[model samples]
Target: MAGPTILSSPSPPSEEAGTILLETERLIIRRYFLSDAPAMAETGNDTLVTANLRAGFPSPYRLSDAEAFLSTACKPDGTAYPQHNGIFVKPLTADNPSPEPRFIGAVGIIPKGDVYFRTWELGYWLGSASWGKGYATEAIGPFVRWCFDTWPGLNRIEGEAYGSNEASQKVMKKCGFIEEGTRRGAAEKLGVLKDVVNFGLLRSDLEGVKELVRDS
Candidate 1:
């Protein structure tokens, strides 16, 4: 809980062009920084942390894994999602009024194709210690609104979680996402098949949730 500034991405200016720095009442959703690797490794290495996540996230998440992620995910290049951002706590410093917050999670939406071209898939994960505190709901409510408000081409956003991960569904619901049903046995995590519970949020839904940012 110490930071006078948001950790800036190490990528070159050209590669960091569209990188966003988002702030909420209690969170700072910004670009991943190289210095955050150690913390990322610590959190990413925990099995409980990645339990509900896909296999794409390394199990024994190492410093190298963190390094690689920062390199690619934080780059300004088009490889990463146009709006991928990090989540940090807004901690107060005794000496400084605004210290750089601690990195606690990651969140973003990736656009899709075909008839879904105007839609984006939302994804997010918080470290073990940061859960059950309404951080995800608060961050998501504003993030979803930002996407719809900032980008006119986007009409809808998609989200999915394992049936076992009820917390994720709740966050989605609180943030205005509708339960669209589930894909049975769509994912296998920890040797057990899990259903993928799908959710979607429309630009229209953002209206009712605009107060989320206001309340914050």
Candidate 2:
């Protein structure tokens, strides 16, 4: 008899502790929670946002999907196996605080094993309302650096941006990811054949980048 088809497991969190909130000068990248589900669903369900992404995200996203995602990404032990983080803008002042942190987007690093075990696949998305602010660039750079710093064995990180996604390609470029090449018809989105541009950053390339300092 054939064995059951099982989903692959994510890599364990490294011995070096992971942070709940990674602060850059302008943004905070943190873990997703059930509380953020409504915002997440709203951001993801936008036609403008979903147009560039894979087909799995339904047009009218449900709260149940968000809950499932939060549970999967954040386990009960408080350790995120696959390492998904939410992007939020920092408030301008210490005294005057925003009621809720604006949900700019989410990013993740998926580790693969093979000849490519040392490589992780990177993916991200930004809400339509958050466009044009350079938040994507700011948030991704530190996240990439943190990933390499935490996992010494990781040599390369790669991502694919659909040809039409100039904003995402710009983020990749700003974060020091070099354009490797293009894969023809690598994905199908919204009934259209999309060409994806491949980008990668090596550990050596990230060596000169400064490590992010934790905020109190």
Candidate 3:
């Protein structure tokens, strides 16, 4: 529900889109499939979930939109999304052994361009039922590690939340992202303009956290 400093020299697109389907201790962050459409429709269509997000996330999100999203997300080896390697899908599921996990949320990055090749914009959303759980923070830490591991050139990943989304801001902070700053009235949603709060994690931040983890 709300978006990096990017300054890099022009570089060739990487060899291939990362084939990462990460399994964290509590989450299965992976690609989207046809089966995810219903749950995606359910969560994404909700204004409660989308209230803080961008307009690209349509209100009254239809089954068609989910279908389209899945279709686009599940692109082939040849078909790629518009920007860089495209917004790869990462629909999170509980890591329970029983009662097969369902798609409870989504996460991915929109790669930046121009002077921002080494940076990306991150985004994610969880169902209201999943709120108050540590899922966002839990999912992001590994995702950050995955990005650093998979795309060696990427230096930072950042996200923006509406100034009102304090929960999301806290989630980012808990995941080791720094509170960079805010842009006043930089976004408009539902006929009103709102300020945006920015949060970010850099490769150096990940390295620092890993060192702390090992030290402890």
Please, what are the lDDT tens digits per residue for candidate 2 over residues 124-187? 8898888886777777888887777666677889998899998889888778888999999988
Judged by lDDT, which candidate is best? Answer: 1
Candidate 2 lDDT (Cα, 0 to 1) = 0.73
- Native-to-model Cα distance after best TM-score fit, residue 198 in candidate 2, in Å: 0.5
Candidates, ranked, lDDT = 1, 2, 3
Ranking by TM-score: 1, 2, 3
Clashing pairs in 3: 1-52, 1-53, 2-160, 3-159, 3-160
Each model's lDDT: 0.75, 0.73, 0.68
* Preferred candidate (lDDT higher): 2 or 3: 2
Residue 78's lDDT within candidate 2 is 36
The per-prediction tally of clashing pairs is: 5, 0, 5
- Which pairs clash (backbone N, Cα, C closer than 3 Å) in model 1? 3-99, 3-100, 4-99, 4-100, 15-76
Better of 2 and 3 by TM-score: 2
Superposed Cα deviation of residue 96, candidate 1 (Å):
12
- After superposition, the stretches of candidate 1 with alpha carbons farther than 4 Å from their true spots are 1-20, 78-83, 93-98, 213-216
After superposition, which runs of candidate 2 have C-alpha atoms over 4 Å from their true positions? 1-21, 76-82, 92-97, 207-216
Candidate 1 global TM-score: 0.84
lDDT of 1 by residue, 62-118 (tens): 999988887777666443344556787876943225566777778877767566667
lDDT of 3 by residue, 1-216 (tens): 112343332432232333334665566666666657777888778888889788888889899988887776766533121122111223342344455565677887887876787888888888776777677777767766766776667888998899999999987876778899999999889989999999888888876677432221
